[model samples]
Target: MDERVTVLKKQIRAVVVAGGTDEITYQSEWLGYLPFPVDHWVEYQGKTFSGDFPFDWTLDDLASLERTGFLEKLEAYENPEDRFDRCIRYRVHIGCA
Candidate 1:
């Protein structure tokens, strides 16, 4: 794999391991995934924010989203560490194949 991709994947995995919700967004052509929809759109700091996961995301894609204020409202609302601990286990057990 490309070094950048590998690096981003690792970072995302680490975030997931550290109790952050690390699901990929599918609204942009960043990765291939099913769409997660949003019901309401909100504006903050003069920018519009919605909750659609971008598609086929890479670090570059996420960075663009962050720059565009899409992730401005992102935050941990629960004990995500424990949730990630349980949820990330499934991902950890998966083989690259």
Candidate 2:
């Protein structure tokens, strides 16, 4: 067996011995699932935010969205922490594999 796998097994055993549940109901993914359909078009801060799913936020009016909390809850697929945070809604990058 691989060294990393052995180390992981030991860690799992430690957790289990400490009364921690090894059965993870929630597994972290590259993207998060959204319940609602994403709008193709959005008008914000006098700017037209239009595109497909997984819009490029870097080209958006981030200042306004940050102030208005429009996309505050949304996170990129490359960002794994926000997806597991559970404190806010996270959007998936639809185009990514």
Candidate 3:
């Protein structure tokens, strides 16, 4: 697992434990304007897709958590008219901690 993913998992665990909630959402904006690398590619369901900044890293990390049974994606929403208007809901599996 990527170190970033590990860090993210820890952060999520802390938040869930403190808030006593099993759900969390991941969302970000202005990624294209960020200084981070924008050239990222991901293959999902045999389709290749590309995204900038957080989108690139965030998607991969969340998928990793899901694969490890740490989280289960409940839903995802994206607005083509406003790229930043997007969010993904996930159920955190506290037991997996």
The model with the greater lDDT, 1 or 3, is: 3
Error of 3 at 39 (Å): 15
Arranged by TM-score with the best first, the candidates are 3, 1, 2
Q: CA lDDT of each candidate? A: 0.32, 0.30, 0.66
Model 1, C-alpha of 7: deviation from truth (Å):
0.7
Write candidate 3's Cα lDDT for 6-47 as tens digits. Answer: 777776776667665577766644556658543333322222
Q: What is the TM-score of each candidate against the true structure?
A: 0.27, 0.27, 0.64
Give stretches of model 3 more than 4 Å off.
Answer: 31-57
Report the Cα lDDT for residue 17, model 3.
78
Weakest lDDT window of 10 consecutive positions for candidate 1: 85-94
Best by lDDT: 3
TM-score of 1: 0.27
Scored by lDDT, model 1 comes in at 0.32
Candidate 2, residues 28-77, lDDT tens digits: the string is 23234576432223322223323321334322333233343322334333
Q: Which stretches of candidate 1 lie over 4 Å from their true place?
A: 20-22, 26-97
Write out the backbone clash pairs for model 3.
none
The clash tally of candidate 2 reads 0
